[model samples]
Target: MSTADTTQSAVVAKLSGLDRFLPVWIAAAMVVGLLAGRWVPGLEGALNAVAIDGISLPIALGLLVMMYPVLAKVRYDRLDTVTGDRKLLLSSLVLNWLFGPALMFALAWLLLPDLPEYRTGLIIVGLARCIAMVVIWNDLACGDREAAAVLVALNSVFQVIMFGALGWFYLSVLPGWLGLPQTDLAVSGWQITANVLVFLGIPLVAGYLTRRLGERAKGRDWYEARFLPKIGPVALYGLLFTIVILFALQGEQITSRPLDVVRIALPLLAYFAIMWAVSYAVGKAAGLNYARTTTLAFTAAGNNFELAIAVAIATFGAASGQALAGVVGPLIEVPVLVALVYVSLALRRRFTASTTEAS
Candidate 1:
């Protein structure tokens, strides 16, 4: 293997064990954030003022920290390899755009309609896909990094286009099914696009630039060994801290409507299960290898809750049901995806062994 591949492989190995525990840590952080929010109600407001222009500083910081490591790991040269994996790209797009949203709408309509707050919340959650977090998960799952990067880039672009369309359609066109009145979908298409660019695209560009600079200054080995690892924990901590502030801001609503957790969890769990099964089956049918299959599975299973929450708070008010639903998504998604990671590992061994035997 090349030097860069060897370095990446070592980093991936060290991360393999740690990856399984991240969901647990994230879950613990959520609980702590919720408790902190409940006890120290003013904390979120204090953090909220840390912003540039109108954007929340805490959130912007979180996005930067969360995205930096992910961006650093991305081999931009891999972008060239993306087109070679036509099956992975097509499967991800179809499942994410068509099947994923359809299932979420059906579940929300069936399960959450009577609860307008939760209904709107589910709608917001369902519309977004995991743009940032999936990269980490894909790496952990030993997925196709090139494919993951392309999907992340594509999903980021699609969220700008599809979020407003999906939001409006879910609210107005699907009102009969969801039993919710038509309300202005709050965020315009342009607004969603702008937020993605600011939150996702900008940070991604910064990350890439930083990685390139590090490579030039210290070489790739030094960059990966020293810089990337240091950034990982910082980013994770920033994400956790931001979650605490968000929960604190929404403390009263969350405390008052405790049952909303149950309301949101059902649809989220259902969505994860259905999407995983579909992605795996489709990948297998297309005759993809294990790594490609895992990439497809996670790409389908994860939602971009950060963007969703931002748009939700912007459009639906911070304490609106929709915003709450978006917050609740990661709480459900993290643990469920961790479980699916194990599932993917099991499937990988089985599939890889079969492939080896066949060959």
Candidate 2:
């Protein structure tokens, strides 16, 4: 076999059982939740009744569980390496913070002019950015792992700081200025801030502390190789658990308004495709090699669906259209990004060919 084929097989082999079939698992969860919600009596009310300070306890737990391990996997101590690459750092910041949110705002507004809840949700999804799954996608595509870790850490910081302000601006202020119909998300700006603090803030701190303390006690090798693998699967468990609950709560709405789900999906599909292609092109034009270019593309394209879903459910409700929109994010993202991984791999070979010819 060719060297490229062998490398490809190895990379694909690294995808754990859960990661490889993520879409299928998520779909199964959705189906189970939907069936339970549709057929079983009083399930929604039971789920709703168990809330801690208005946020669903199950969902809050799921959000934390879904986020913490991923954050722990970030190589926080090595951030300076990525920071030194000004071209890559500046490009990533621009693509993630500036261009990504703006593009989603435009697409959400353009595509879902009449559906304010889904639009707001999409905007929230955009603002959340990718702090978790981009690492996996980057690795699958042979992107620079250290770059992905640093970028994910960078995104986590921005998400906590900017999510609420950006949420208020896009959901309330921007629409008013544009003379567009604004959504009464029924939550104040401060409430959004509080939710961001509780959900993203808590997990970020916990993850950082876990990494620092673990590495200090047991060394980096033990922390990453031994400790991280043990907790890695928990994130998937939490993700699936959250998805089931979300779909169950919103089952009636989802089943009733299937078209709205499709409507919600269109903007997301476009956002991922456009953001990735543009970010990849930007990375290449800026003279990044294939790995860093791929890293930039995945990091720029992915969203923090866990954060978005938590925020949507916390700010709105578990059964809100906004929450449903958040749920749809990973459904669309998993398959699309999995496809993009192969696309990145194909382009990697092309990149190599071009470099060889140039030399």
Candidate 3:
């Protein structure tokens, strides 16, 4: 095989172990989180007892840990490259902010209108946008790594700016404007801005400094191939830890209203599938290649549940039904994205042919 073929095989081999079995790890997390919440007396409470301003300290740390590695991998210098792919970039932003949120808003109302807290929670999940985990899904689908990195960075900034205002508009303002029943969300503008700074703000700065310093010290070759490999798994490990802590705190909610998780998941599952189809079709129609297409698709379909969960807990209490809805986003997100990864891979076959023919 050519050197390129060999390198591709090696990369796939490295990614496949964790990427292919992500659903399993998530399932394990669910089981252990539920069991710990049920069986271990005071464990959930103990972890949650250590909180400031209604945010669980452990999950906050976990989210920070999970986020930094993903952020650190971004080549911020290459972000300029996305500007050239204006159609690709524009498509991602439109789908994520406009179409994606509207679809989620409609779904939340249509699916669980009576459960106002949970519906608001679902809306929060949609509005936050995916900054971190979609990188994993994007990579698994052989997306443009550079584009994925750029979009991740872009979305991080976008969410910090847009999430607060858009969230207010959808959950509070627009509903009142439209004469629909408002969810009566109590999150203040200051609180919303602070949450963004506390969460995304820290990691974005840290990741930027880390990358710049690493490159200056060791150079790009060492930073990408050697440095990144060692730390890349931190995100996945922290993700599982957060999942356990989340379900642990939600033990009572899970046990009493297990079906509520399912009910909430219904819109989420539909959201993922529909969002993928929409982004995928849009990418193809825009004449983007397979890599860019899958990158946009994953970016559109995925949720920034870490931010969503944090906002929910900060806005609503940790044990609130809203927080429970935030937890369910990942639960519903993982398996569905895993399935979409397969679908995107299958679609890649067709996309590759079309691109080749056009070229």
Report the lDDT tens digits of candidate 1 across residue range 273-298.
Answer: 89988899999999988878888889
Off by over 4 Å in 2: 52-54, 114-121, 132-149, 164-227, 289-291, 305-327, 345-359
Q: Which residue pairs come into collision in candidate 3? A: none
lDDT (Cα atoms) of all candidates against the true structure: 0.75, 0.80, 0.80
136-197, model 2: which lDDT tens digit per residue? 57865778867876776677677667776777788888889999877554434554445556
lDDT pick, better of 1 and 2: 2
Q: Give the TM-score of candidate 2.
A: 0.78
Compared to the true structure, candidate 1 yields what TM-score? 0.86
| Residues 78-144 of candidate 3: C-alpha lDDT, one tens digit per residue | 8778779999989989999899999999999899978988898999998878876686677667788
Q: What's the residue-level lDDT of 299 in candidate 3?
A: 91
User: lDDT for model 3, on a 0 to 1 scale?
Assistant: 0.80
Candidate with more favorable, higher TM-score: 2 or 3: 3
Report residue 343 deviation for candidate 2 (angstroms).
Answer: 3.9
Q: How displaced is residue 322 in candidate 3, in Å?
A: 3.1
Q: Model 2: number of clashes?
A: 1
How does model 2 fare in lDDT?
0.80
